[model samples]
Target: MENCKQEFEEVDVVFSKTKHLTKEECTKLQLQDSRLVSEFQASKLEIDAKKNWDLFYKRNETRFFKDRRWTTREFKELVNGGKSCSGKVLMEIGCGVGNLIFPLLEEEPNIFVHACDLSPRAIEFVKNHPSFSSDKINAFVCDITTDEITRQLELSCVDVVTLIFVLSAIHPQKFAICLENIYKLLKPGGIVLFRDYGLYDMAQLRFKAGHKISENFYMRQDGTRSYYFSIEFLRDLFTGAGFNIICNDYVHRRTINKKENLDVPRIFVQGKFQKPS
Candidate 1:
């Protein structure tokens, strides 16, 4: 058991190696997704984005996403790169129901977190969790694309920012302003840890006709939107927001469930970007 645990730490198992999609497969999927969502429906989805997310949590609560136990393993900066994590201030944008926040706090109890989500229902879940404490976490509702986070927390106060699976929910047109808001919250030397769905992932390929909002962007049945990212596009995005890229790449993994006869390949873009010191 000890040996297995050691191997888990040594290997980059957070993102398992998986086979890439072939050109023929990509072409077939694209061909099947030729029909696009009507402009009226797309506009409605964008306008009601927050409302839709609130409804999502109201229905599923914290059951939708599993606890993100792999965050520390995937991002060393979260643990101060083997140094003490004491006194570090971190912020998690789009913190849904405290899935990442609670596990992260359990892992490193000394660090404080400021967690925000677009859905007020989600914030309530974070606040009501059994492990929640006012001293350790400040959970709030925020629309990062437009709201001034500095109003709730001071400017340049964050040491690190975690944007896991969050940016993809936003409209592509607002991504610049969203990143700019996050940039304002980080200290000069602070880093942003980003992870999100990548182009041609199984989820993206699964979208059928009338789901596509635009290239690499789609609206789910529940009305929340998602935008797929490529490594080059992600690099340009962070760089354009005045963040210097420390590292950025695509992470591939395979999800398997023998009981259900399910096997799916997942692609994600993960990166670390720093504000110029």
Candidate 2:
């Protein structure tokens, strides 16, 4: 058993090798063309964000994203010693196809989940899933930017809110409003767990010249928008909303495809912010 454990550790070490880039290198890699926005296209994308997301779900169904299995390891408070959560409440803000929530439910059956998404189709998929229990999971449609979240959930009741790759989808101008709504939904001591694209990530650098919508934001060919964030910007946004940062850092990983001869570095900014008691 000890030898097997050692072998696994060595494998992990080999795969975890990452290459860090300097600021100059990253700047040079970003879309070098002028960041210009076409008013017509910008307006269309903003208005059709929901429509685009709905189409995305209709086309991909529930299979596009892999289940996130790292939550339990990253946020230990979600489960207690491989057992149940003892009934902590969690809200997943872009709960697509029950990925994070379902895995978490499997781990801690006693915990309750409030899952919301802007796409009704995504919520429908979650509700129809075989493991979905109406008693334990409340699946609803909510637009954090415009909807009154309190109407859907009791104010100051959530214990933890997970925002995994959700914020990057919204327009940067509305980020503050979205964060403010999330702030009101959490209890005085509630925590917000965040993980999203970091500035100059490979995905960001790959955008073509015409796709740049604004500084660090772009629209993909699919009509969905993505915004890359810097740690300082995220800290300011969360702190301005009255949350105290518990932990904030960039998570860097390198993926190597030997067959394709490709080595890609991915950077993601993750944070845990607590609403002060």
Candidate 3:
């Protein structure tokens, strides 16, 4: 339950739901819907703050990911795939306080990661981390829709676009632009690896009526927000932007409070979107 709250505060994304992918009609519908998109007209997009990300991490840091509950084993599989990241330049969108970045370095220490976040505080913490490497991990402040970071990462020349938990925060209208920017940054055939909240997880049901910011989008009392997604919407968004959807699936999760006999539902979507060769 609190995973929802922590999810928002950590990097501000999540709203889970999904039907069985095997359902024939549902699968067909998801494949054909192009105009489908969520509305987040009321959400905020700016992350103006001081250069230092210390206070930001201090307030939101958690050992949760240290348990590896959220990421599963997909990271290692791709990182060590037939294609290697040994000399590749990678860019991570919505990279919070180095939670995902530092561990990635541990996997392939020679590879460099160009990462950004809207929050200055988030960037600050990542820049100042103990494993922080000017050569391997370049942390910076950026907003995907408005910032010019492509030139800063020119030396690295991005080969991969990592979108872990990033898309849901963006206002709907800007999503296309976000994809466009990623495409521009990436080398041809570059892979965009991503994972985020799904459609009808318990978190979405927890929202009271007034919290709804738009269809399938909601804001908590905290500044954090979330958007539930249908698989079709994601396919259309990336496919229309010229990326091929290689893998997309819904994962159902259940959390148990053994002592209290409580079982909670959670859902997540994971995908590999690839630019054409």
Best by lDDT: 1
C-alpha lDDT of all candidate models, in order: 0.87, 0.84, 0.67
**Which segments of candidate 1 are over 4 A away from where they belong?**
1-24, 257-262
lDDT of 1 by residue, 54-150 (tens): 9999999989999998899889898887788999999999999998989888878999999999999999999889999999999999999895686
Question: Candidate 2 clashing pairs?
Answer: none
Better of 2 and 3 by lDDT: 2
- The sequence of per-residue lDDT tens digits that candidate 3 reaches over residues 173-230 is 6788889888878787788888887876567656654566666666555546677777
TM-score to true structure, per model: 0.90, 0.89, 0.76
Across residues 1-277, which tens digit of lDDT does each residue of candidate 2 receive? Answer: 0243322211111112223667866675564455556979999999999899999999999989999987787777678557657768899999988999999888788889999999999999999999999999999988989746878888898999999999999999999999899999999999999989887778887776688888888889899999998888998999999999998777775665555666667777888999999
TM-score of 2: 0.89
Best by TM-score: 1
User: Looking at candidate 3, what is the lDDT of residue 246?
Assistant: 85
Q: Which candidate model has the greater TM-score, 1 or 3?
A: 1
